[model samples]
Target: MDNVRIFELAKKLNITSQKLISLLEEMGISVRSHMSSLDSKVAEEICRKVKPKAQEKATIPRSQEKAQSRTSEVTLAETGRKKPVQVSPGISLKEFADLIKKPPSTLIKILLGYGEMLAINAPLSEEMLALLAEELGLEVEVKTVEESLLEEGEGGTPELLESRPPVVTVMGHVDHGKTTLLDAIRHTDVVKTEAGGITQHIGAYQISYRDRKITFIDTPGHEAFTSMRARGAMVTDIAVIVVAADDGVKPQTVEAINHARAANVPMLVAINKIDLPNANPEKVRKELSELGLVPEEWGGETIFVEISAKNKTNLDDLLEMILLVADMQELKANPHTRGNGVVIESRLDKGRGPVATVLIKKGTLKTGDIIVAGDVHGRARALFNDRGKRVKQATPSQPVAVVGLSAVPSAGEEFLVVDEEKTAHQITAERIARQRARIAGPVRRLTLDDL
Candidate 1:
């Protein structure tokens, strides 16, 4: 019969049409009639060829091989010696089930019996797989680097890598030299370089120290460092909180601290404007203690460093402290893998189209790499560092401004370089469709009185 009729028959038999067709193709069946005109003899021959042989089923014992052969079979009831599964990147429940020839629902039920309480569609962890394998008498082994790396050139690396960069967000009250501190760290005149000498938009910068890299997100205070803090929390590995020694802890400074605390990132305090005559580091430290940022000297976890952006005092100390925290936390990456990075900020450039400041967390970002940032996808045409120098490639922990995006992606969007434009376009289309669905729904409006 024709493919459509073959599919109809396969569905009637409660099997996947594709599977049935594949079986028929393998058996050399070439029926091409419509559903209504198919000859009974031809149909019978097709069914006989596609159906599993009775002798094949008889070869293995029912208890041992039944579940292994049947796609619909599941081991719901737990065995006594169940091991927990640890979830890793790119693996899904359906794929796991397919590997074991069991239904996803059956696997999910087995996980729930072991206290996982996961849905059929929920992502499966290695721990979950281990548990399932233990109960089902399957061997569990850790994936090797060679096998994982084999997928790199083949474009099969998972979107979320096992390891990620530590997100460092810069926060402080208005005009507390937060931007200046970031500019000083990156050696960029971002504060004075901006159109109005004020960072009206959120900016992302990546700084390299002794072969290590740390990302710094510069957020605006006039608008409630909310967007900045949110981005920081989403990807942050740590927080560099700027507090003016002359001004002590102001309202927004307190807010920034709260954001860092809420995100649970380790904090390092920068007591800025140390060059000022009225600057008081001791008083600032005491005030910060009241706000719950007890410095390390005071037996708390936070580290406070006194600095002056104008005179660049104690800048080396600040960098060293950041590196110390990162090292203590074991900040590392496999630089030989495919490139993955985070969007520090995205904006429409007047002459360059959509420009994005992306921190290269791992691998190398080169010109003409097809990239997708959130819903926006495009190839990188040009890359520039904070110094405005054009570069061909950026390695781990380096930040670069890239041009030639299809559109301005949102700030804090994660980006990945893919192999082909078709794949990028497909992913971008799916993301845009999801975004539309999210925004198309009725939105709850908050009135001014709600405040």
Candidate 2:
């Protein structure tokens, strides 16, 4: 058959052109007007959906009946879980359900359970992709990081995109063993009582495990994590929420889960305090599953690791899960380009002047690079790693303390490297001006008498 016009299809289906167009739009099939054309495939799909009565009344050949029944029975459910399904963001629910070989009705029902009144024709967001898959007991892989690599070219080709360490954020309640867990991983005493050690200071540290690296952002809680997101920086790849097995899930724990979900970062749960006699890992799993973070052991995708930070038990297992998730994400960056990153933290030091801890998301940051962060522009006079050791250069996913910003930058500010100091100044100046304009509002004109 030939490509069908919107009006023709609408007439054939006994529906108005506008209604048919709305349906097409819901499917994300960009037909604009009554005269818009639909390809043969789309026309067939429309006919199948709108003319269901005709299809039901139509007779099928005896030879093809068995084949049709077999095709209907064969789906992802029958095939069993093979490999994770790779999905691109912004696909319609119908498209996604078809990709997973599941019925669109199932997806719609799942969405309704989550209070999302979306239809099968609605386009699913990236977060929805992960959520719907989890509920259906399927795995979905969204091509976000690699698509970003291609977009953030930074004057380099795809060849420059290489594997980078995953930036993992740990968030939870105050007394749920977050500090102790971090201390165990880094082998350093985190001052739980002082903000200078963890709360006030937003820092990121990397640990080498089994010849691979994992970077952890030590933020106070979900607040700091979301603050960075609000600044338009997606610095975190995976979020590991620390939950106490003995205490079960607390109010703050729920907040952390919601924050992680809102950020749309993949989550792994660390069931801490398992060393306690009263610890109940199963209870913790049940509570988290109710919050939509079902553990893999329970037939869901979320990884749950029961550990005791005090004894440093099962720490390797948690780190291994993090690496496994990171590997699946396929994190990469173009380290050869100019530095691009976000400010993890910044403060004015009496001796060193304005010091900013920046996590380089892509490219190599050097000591002599002219950089602009938010509204501040300066030369990177020096660079120091998480260990306070002086470093000449930093690569992708490497967090470094930079010296030479004229003013302390806010955490989560976008940090960039430019060709010259003047360009940096120009960019920062423009940003500052724009901020001022927003604050000042539109200029008020004089009244008619004054004019």
lDDT of each: 0.70, 0.80
Query: Best-fitting candidate, measured by TM-score?
Result: 2
Residue pairs with clashing backbones, model 2 = none
Regions more than 4 Å wrong, model 1: 1-167, 186-188, 208-214, 222-233, 441-451
Clashes of each: 14, 0
Question: For residues 225-299, could you state the per-residue lDDT of candidate 2 as single tens digits?
Answer: 778788778789999999999889998889888877888898999999998999999999998889888876566
User: On residues 1-451, what C-alpha lDDT tens digit does candidate 1 reach at each position?
Assistant: 4434554565445454445655665767654321223446766776775554321111223233334424322343233443333223345788677766788888877887988887556676767777988888776554422233224433222322223345577888888887888877777677876666667877766677766566777778623235434544255677888888898988988887787787777889999998999999999999989988887667676788999988899998888677656544545454545677777777888899999988776667899988888788899999998668999998666778999899998776768887788767756665676679778998879999999
In order of appearance, the predictions have TM-scores of: 0.59, 0.64
